[model samples]
Target: MPELERDNEVELAYGVRLRSSGVSATVGDVRQAPTATRPVRGVVADELLGDSGDAVARLLPVVEAAGMRTVLAVPLDDVQVPPTPFGGVRALTGEENYVELSVPGPDPDEGQVVLEVDEVGLVRWHIDVEAAATAVAIADNGTALAARGVAPVRAGIEQTFRIPIVQLDQGGVGGQQRGFLGFGVRKVLHLIRFPIEAAAAAVGKAVVGWWEDRRRPHALSLVTPESLGDVPPPDGVSAARLAELADKPFLVLVHGTFSTIRSGFAGLNRSGGGQPDLAELVARYEGRVLGFDHQTLHVDPTTNADWFLRRLPTDRPVTLDLLTHSRGGLVGRRIADPALAAAAGVPTPDVRRLIHVGTPNGGTVLASPKRWTTLIDVFTNLFSMLPEEVATPTAEAVIELVKQVATGVFNGLAGLTAMDPGNPAVTAANAQVFGGGASGAAGAVRAITSDFTPAAEDLRLRALNAIVDPFFGTGNDLVVPTQGVFEAGDYRVTDPFVVQSPSAVVHTAFFSDVRVRAKLGEWLPGAV
Candidate 1:
C-alpha cells in the first residue's frame, strides 16, 4: 500500500502508478478487504448485485484460492490527473501508448464517481494471454459505476485503456437525483481481467436471455381485462384461444425496443384524477386484444413482422388493428405491408386502424452508429431517473451493449439500426408502407407524438435534453423526433395527436398521460 504525495509519482502493486498534484489518495491491493471497502461507501450491495449477492460471494473463495491481486484507489479529496500525451506516431509504429484519467470533483447531488479523459492516454496493464483488461468503477453495493474495455497494444502481454467520459446523470431516479458515478458516495476502481472468450460468451448468453425474457420473439398472447398489465405468459395463447378469436377483429399491442407487453402497456391498467383507464378498451373490444412480444435489438422490424405472420393461424382470415409505441410502429407497418402479407401467404387485407404512440415511423437520429453511445447514455440516465416508466431489463441490455461497444465489437445493432434515419431498412420500409398511397394496407394510421422539453426546474432532464436535442434538430420525446413519428418520406399523418411542450410526457410516459388515454378511447372505441 502507498499514499499519493502531492507532486510525486507513487508506484503501487501490479505495475500501476499514480501522479497527482492536488489530491490526497491511497492505492492498495483490492484483495485487502478493508482497503477495498473504504472507497465504496453508501453503495447498497444488493442493488448492484442481486438480492442474494451470490455472484461475488461465489467469486471470493476462488480469488483467495488462486492468490490473485487487484489494485484499488481511494481519493481522499477531489483528484485530477495532469494532462498527458501518449498515443501518436509511436502507437502507429507498434510502440507503447499512454492515456490520462480525468476524475471530476465530487458533486453532492450526484452520488457516483465518473471517469473521464481529456486526451487519449492508455493505462497499460500486463495480463494473461486469455484475458481482456477492463477498467471498472464499482459502488460499495456492487452496482457498476462505470466500465471501459482495454485495447491490447501488444496481444496477450500488454494492454492499454482510456476511461470513456460518460455522463450518466440526466434525470431523477425514483424521485431522487442520482448520477452514474455515485460521486459523493464511496467508490472503488478496479482494473479487472477476464477470459476474452468467456466474457464474450457470457455477453452473448445475456443478450439471448434478455431477448427471450423480454422480447419473447414472435410470441402472441391474449390480453384480457384481468391480465392487461401482467407479463405475457411464456407459452403464449394456445390453439384453442386462437380458434375462439378466429374471424374477429383484434387489437394487437406492439411494444417498443427493449420492452415486453407488460412493460409497454401496463400503465393502461391504472387510472387516476378522472382519467379513463385503457382497460376499458379491452372490455370494449370484447376481450379480443392480443400482445405481440418480439425481438427488437438483433433483428430488423421486417424480420419481426415475418415471424409474427408465420405464427398466425392460416386456417382463418384475420383482420387486425394495431396500437404501437416507439419502434413498434415500424413493425406494425411492416406487418401491414400488403406485399409482406402476400409473401407470408396470410390474407390480412388491411389493418383496420393503427395508433402509434411515440412510434419512430420516420426513424430517429439516435439510432445511427455515431450516436449509439449517446443513445445508451441517455437511456441509462432515463432508466435511473424514471425507473418505473422505463423497462428494467432494458437497462441491463444497455450495459452489455456498452461493454461490447467499448471493446470495439459492437455492430450497428440491426433492430436499433432500423430506426436510424439513414439506414436502408428505414427507407425501404417507409417506401413500401407509404409509397403506394398515404394509406397502405396499414390503413388510417394515426400518431401520438410529443415535443418534450423539460421544465426549467428539472435541471437533470434539461441537461439530458441539452445533450440529445442537437442530434434531432427538432422537437422530440427524448428518443424519437416528434415530427418523425407522424411524417416520413412521402407521408404525413393528417391529424396526429401532439403532446405539446411544457408537458412531462416523455416517450415512455406517453401511455400514462390522461390526454393520451382519452385519445385512445376516441380512436379505438372497440367493437362498435
Candidate 2:
C-alpha cells in the first residue's frame, strides 16, 4: 500500500506508460501542478513500487527508497496486461512518445486541465501542454499515457507540456518562459464540451471576439504635406541646399499619408525653389534625421505603427526638431507615451517652437462629413440586405471596409480633440506628461464664409458645426461650410476662424496664384 508521513505529505511522483503500433517505452516522474514546496521523498518510493511493475525494476534503490518511478516499466517486446483491467490510463506503443498523461473527468473543467513542464537533464522530448486539459499522465521524460477509457483531450482547456533538456537549472528548459506569453491572465473563454471538437470551436470563437474588440483605432487622420521652400533658389539658394544644419536651426520634415521614405524625400526635392536632398539634410544637421510610419487607417494604425517601430533602431540619440503634415502628427504624439518615452530614454517634446504646415490640427469638417455619412451608411447596410449603392456592397467586404473607415475617422477625431487645449481628453492625456504643459495645438482652419457676406444683409453669425452649412458653421471646409465639422465646443460667431496657411491658400487658388511656389519658397526656406 502507498504510505504517507504523519508530519509531511509525501510527494507521489506521477507518470504514464504508453504503447502504440507494437512499441512501448517508459516515462519518468513528471510534475502535474506547481507546488509551493518540494514533495516528500517517501511518497515517490511507494508510487514506483505499487502500480508500475516493470518500472519498479529499474528505480534506483536510492531513488526508489525516495519513492520515484520511471514511466515505461515494461518492455514493448512483452505484453503482460490484459488491457481490460486498465480503467484511467491507456497504453500505446510505437506511435510518437509511448507515454501520455491521463486524468479522468466527469466533465471538463479547469480542475481537469493537465499541466506539465519540460523535464530537465535527461529524457528530453518535445511536448506541448499549454492551458490544456487532458485525460493523460506525463513522465519526467515527457512520455505521456492516454486515459484508457476517457474521451480524447478536449478544447477550451489548455494543455501545457514540453520536452526534457540537458540543462536542469539554467532557466530556459523547454522554452517554458517564452511559451507562456499570456501569464497571469485568465483566457477569456472557459467553456466545456464533449468530443473535444465542440469545445475547440467555442475556444476559437472567444479568441476571435477578443481580437475584434481590439482591432479599431479610437481616432486617426491623413496629413497633407508641409512645404518649406523659398523663392526660386537664387544663386545663394543653391548653397541653401548645401547649407550646414548644425546650429542653423534644423527643420525636421515628417511625411504624412501613404508616403514611403523614398517618395517623401523625392517629393521634397521636386517641390520648389528647392532645398537639400535627404543625404544633404542628414549631412548638414548635427542631429540625426528620423522618419515614422503611422498605422494605415485602411489597416490597423496601432498594429501597423507597432510594426513600423519594431523596424526602427531607437537605441541611439537624435536631436529633436519636428514638422508633421497630416496624420503623421498623431503618430508622432503617441510616441510621447510616458512608458514608451521612458523605455526609449527620450525627453518630452518641446512643442512650443513646433510649427505645422498643412496639418488639420482641428478636426477637418470636410473629412468629418464624409466620415459621418460613411458611419451612417455602415449602420444602414448592416441592418439591411439591400444592395449598397456605395462603392462596394458585399456584406463581408462592406463590414471590413466600414471597420477600416471607422478606425480612421475615430482616431482622427480623437487626435484632433486631444490637441485642443480646453478639450477634456487633452487634459487627461497630459496628466502624465512631465511638467504637464498642454500639448501643442495649431493647424489651418478653412474659412467657410464668402468675402461678400458682410455686404449682404440678413447674415446671422453661427458656430462652425456641420458639412451642409454655407458659412463656416461647425462642419464647413472653405467650400463645404462649418456645419460639417460640428461637435460640442466653444466655436462662436465673434471669433470665427479664417484660412491663412500658405498651403490652404495654394489649395484655394492653385491656378490664380502663379506665385504660389514663390510663396511656398518664402514660407519654407529649406524646401526644394
Candidate 3:
C-alpha cells in the first residue's frame, strides 16, 4: 500500500484481489491527517450504488483534487443482472462510504488487475497481467446497481463507486470479471430464441380448440350439398348461377406470406390498381372461389402446409385447382399426398391445374445459413413464447435457453450421416433452421446448397428456372426450373404446343408467361 500525505492530512490506500467471491479489505482508505489506517465500517447495501445521483456526479471533482486521475464507477447495464462500469471517472468524494473499494492496480495477470479504495478517498491498485480490463460492474452486497442504461446519480454530496470487471476480446466477444470487493459480482447476458417444438405445440393446441369451435358450423360449406332454396341472388352479386356449380371443381386459393384470403375479397369489394380478385375474374366465367387460412408467423412452413393440406375436403371425387405464392408452392407440393386428400374428406383431386406466383420452391437464402436462422428463430419465438407485456429481459432469458437447447439438438443431428428420407419431420426443415443439422436432409441440405441471394446477376438462372424449367425434357415454359414447378410424373403441359393433350390449354397458362391470367376467362367462362 502507498500512502499520500499533504496539508496535515494523510490518505492511505489498500488493494484487494477477487475471483468469484465477495472480497474482504484489511485497511480501508483513511484521509484524516493522523495516518491511522483502519478498516472502514459500513453496511453493504443489498443495492450497489446508493440512490444519490448528485453524489455520483460530484465524484470526479473530489478525486481530481486528490491527485487521482482514474476512478472506477460501475453503472448498471441491466438492472436484473450485476452492474458493470465500462465508463471511467476521475475521483471520489470523502462523503461516500465503502468498507473496501476494489481498484484496478498497476500489475495485471493475464491482462487483469486488482485494486482497493479506502475512506481517505485514495485508491491503491495493481495490474497483474498485460491485458487491461475494458469494463467493471458495481454492486453492493451482491446486488447490481448500475450498468448500461442506468444513468449515473447526479448528486454532489458524499459519493461511492463500485464496478464489476468486464473483459473485451479482439474478436468482439466480451466477458465480466469476477467480483473483487464487497457485494459486487459479475454477471453475463445472452441473446435468446423460441423453441420450435414448444411453440408449435402451444399453437397446435390453440388451433385445435379453435377447430372444435368453428369446424361444424363451417363444415366445408363450399362443397356441402345444399338445396338451392328458390331465393333470388342479391341485386349486385353476379354469382347466382355459379353458386350451383360451386360444389363442383371447387377452386381454393392459398395466399403466400404476409397475405390473407380476405385480401382478395377486400380487393373485390374495393377496386385497386393491382390485379382483381379471382372471384371477379372468374365470376364472369362462372367460377367459384374458396380461401383457406393457416398460421403465418407462429407456424413453421412445413407444419402449416401439412395442416392446410389436411384441412382440404377430399371425401368425394373432385377437381381442385390451386393458386399460391411464395412458399405456398411447397404447400401445393406436399398436398399431393393421397392420404391427406382422403383425410380432407374429398376424393383424390383430378390433378386439374396448379399455378404458383412468385413461389420459392427451394428455401429462401435469406433464411439460410447461420445468422439468418438465428434471426428468424428469435423473431418467431418472440411471438410464440412471450405475452406482449412480459418484460423483454425475462422473455429474452427464456428465449436464450430455448435457443441453446435447439442449438445443441441441431449440432447432435448434424453429426449424423445416415437418416430416413421420407419421414416428414426428418425431411422438412433445414439442419441450420435453428442451427446445424444431421445428414443434411431436406432442410439441412437446402440450407447448405440453395442460394437465396438478391444479387441480380445470379438471378438470371433462377428466374429462368422459376418460369421456364418446370416443363423441362418434354417441354417447358423456359422460365420456371423443370425440377421445381413440375412434378416428376407430369407431362401434360410438357408436351409440345401442337402435340399437347386435352388439358394443355387448361394448363397452358401455367407454363406460359404470367400474362395469360388476363385471358383465363376465355376457357373457364368466368375465371380470369
lDDT by residue (56-152, candidate 2, tens digit) is: 2222232233222222121111111212252211221112222233222212321121111111101111122321112111211222221212222
Find the 10 residues in a row with the least total lDDT in model 3. Answer: 440-449
Judged by whole-model lDDT over C-alpha atoms, candidate 2 comes out at 0.27
Residue 291 of model 3: what lDDT?
Answer: 53
Query: By the lDDT metric, which is better: model 1 or model 3?
Result: 1
Model 1 Cα lDDT, one tens digit per residue, 47-157: 221111222333223322222223223222222222226311112111222222222211221112121111111111122111222111111122221221222122222
Q: Judged by lDDT, which candidate is best?
A: 1
Indicate the worst ten consecutive residues by lDDT in candidate 1: 115-124
Which candidate do you rate higher for lDDT, 1 or 2?
A: 1
What's model 3's lDDT at 89? 14
Q: What shift in Å separates residue 454 of candidate 1 from its native position after superposition?
A: 1.2
Q: What is the clash count for each candidate, in the order shown?
A: 17, 86, 92
Instruction: Determine the backbone clash count of candidate 3.
Output: 92
How accurate locally, in lDDT, is each candidate?
0.56, 0.27, 0.28
Alpha-carbon runs more than 4 Å astray in model 2: 1-253, 257-267, 273-290, 298-316, 336-339, 343-353, 365-436, 439-528
Q: Positional deviation of 47 in candidate 3, in angstroms?
A: 26
Give lDDT tens digits, candidate 3, residues 1-528.
222111112223332222221211222232221211211111111122222232222232322222222222222121112233752211121112112223322211001112232111112222211111111111112212112211111212221223222221112113433322211222211101111223322443322122222321111213101211111122212234333454566555554432333331222333233444344545543445545444332244454545554444433444456555434544554454455455655444543445544343423322221112222222222222222222222222222222222222211111010111222232343222221222111110110001122122222222222222221232322212223332212211232112122222211122222223432322232232
Ranking under lDDT, best-scoring first? 1, 3, 2
Model 3 misplacement above 4 A: 1-246, 263-279, 282-287, 296-315, 343-345, 369-528
Model 1 off-target regions past 4 Å? 1-215, 225-229, 387-390, 433-436
